[model samples]
Target: MNERPRGIESVLVVGTGLIGTSVALALREHGVTVKLTDQSPGAVRVACELGAGDEWEPGGDRVDLAVIAVPPQFVADWLLDLQKTEAARFYTDVASVKALPIEQARRLGCDLSAYVAGHPLAGRERSGPGAARADVFLGRPWAYCPGRETSPRAVAAVLSLIELCGGNAVKVDPVAHDEAVALISHAPHVAASAVAARLVGASDTALGLAGPGVRDVTRVAGGDPDLWTVILSGNARPVAEVLEAVATDLAAAAAALRAVSVDDDGAIARVTELLRRGNAGRSRIPGKHGGPARAYAVVQVLVGDRPGELARLFQVAQDAGVNIEDVRLEHAPGLPLGAAELSVQPESAEVLAEALRSHGWHVP
Candidate 1:
């Protein structure tokens, strides 16, 4: 058989955590030779064991491209040293924030011509390669920031890499990237964490009453605090700037609640409007990778844990000429009843609920 084209053949992935290992797996799936390394020896070993990449030794033969997925604080310094050693002909990073590292690179007198800054806007609350998914970046937006010293070839290489991993590339200035993510991504993490922290000292009985709304709101709070501390600390100024606006809104809420005997209609209206704004804002968050948000119909159903209960319910939906887009099994183990939140087209939701109810399922 003829040999494959050799341009940008070998790629090195530094840091074999969730992001790094995921990148390696995605590249390897494209038949690209991937070399994986990490500061944690066990992590590297685990990544290799999980088929992320071939084991890589430090100061080895230079690869065509190097993707550094280290934490934000270390990216700039690491890139500087790698550039000095000519570790790779082209370099990019997967750090959430970009401007600080880019500035640090320039200060270190590294050849910026060989580097590009990139961020993949995809992650789970979980950390490490064990949580890495090959399709993690599929259809997701990957931001690219080209420095003045970055070469056209390097930019192209990174773009191709993003595409190979099934991500769409969006170019923006490094500073803009940081600020945008501060609003959309970083800010949400802090908000989720804060909300979750408030539940820490709550009574067990109070916590037992938690529902899906609370779970969804606090989901990202389960993320590694150590990692989040680095991310928030690295982008402190931008994140703090966004938080100040949130604080102002919160203060307004507090003042409204404290107003005694005053006609609180205006304050109540403001709160309601704020909640409405939240619904509008949340609807704009791209669904699954630039797709329309997954619209769900809340189907309140009484379900038993008996065998074939789920299968029978689904069969009824299928028979009703309704397609179930997605299903959330919300049930407490050892309980006889549960609710299935069915995510379906708005048009089909009512039909499915009716059909299920007709089939003797208590679907509200």
Candidate 2:
């Protein structure tokens, strides 16, 4: 682990949610004193119990940095209040949307020089302090938006914070950051929710027939709706713009499907083109190590529904000296066994499969 940044001996982390607690934990691990606070006293207590940080109290020594890990809508208000109190020499936030909060801070007459906006592009499907992991930001992009008026010292402090968390810091303008996340993060979340909403009226048999495809598409939809509502609404314009384009594509897809139902041969080409474009778009997403994405090969293993089955499967991969890039479990309704798809680099896939077979595991 890297040493804590210079002059940042202590940090005041506001809002002891997943991101806040994770930041506190990472900072505390690096010998930086962290003080935790939240509107919900219970949340702060939970985070403190998790060793994220000590409970924050007024009249404490001034900290070098103050991180506001609140939702997008609440960031500006906190920024204004923190400034009124001279909370820290520098301040930053971990809100997903940037432009709104920046504009709000400006409107509130807060000192821009003392504040830098930041967002850590890391999270799980779960939320709250219990789901927080100290290593969540590792190898992920932590974006910082320091406006023209933002001080260099503030920017440096935030960059150091990202470094302490073992994250790669990327500098971006606030407006650009908001627009980018709308397409990549915010809008996709809305689309996922829309797709998942269709399941509300779906027959039990239809839902039971769902495979990894549906599960993967709707996975993010499982996120807290109340939280996402605030996020989507905060970036409403950008998100809506992207959703409009998605609607166009969806309409075309529906028309093509309808045409195919009528046995129109030309509809197949249209559907194939849409799918091809999707493939091309997906391919453009940067992969690990900042290189063009490499397609991984998957080896499926059948595991009986019992304790330690997953642990045994992982041990098999560890013994084979194969690094699993990703793993997904798919279980059909009423099935006693589930299939675990272990994704590895193409060369390692065959090796992994062979090794699992030799270990008396079903690799089919």
Kindly report which residue pairs in candidate 1 clash with one another: none
Candidate 1 structure quality by residue, lDDT tens digits, 263-332:
7666676667677887787677643222354544556578786544665566577688775554455567
Candidate 2, residue 24: CA error in Å? Answer: 0.3
Shift of residue 106 alpha carbon in model 2, Å: 0.8
Residue ranges of candidate 1 with Cα displaced over 4 Å:
1-7, 260-265, 288-364
Which residue pairs does candidate 2 place in steric collision? none
| lDDT score of residue 254 within candidate 2 | 92
TM-score for candidate 1: 0.77
TM for every model, in the order presented, reads 0.77, 0.80
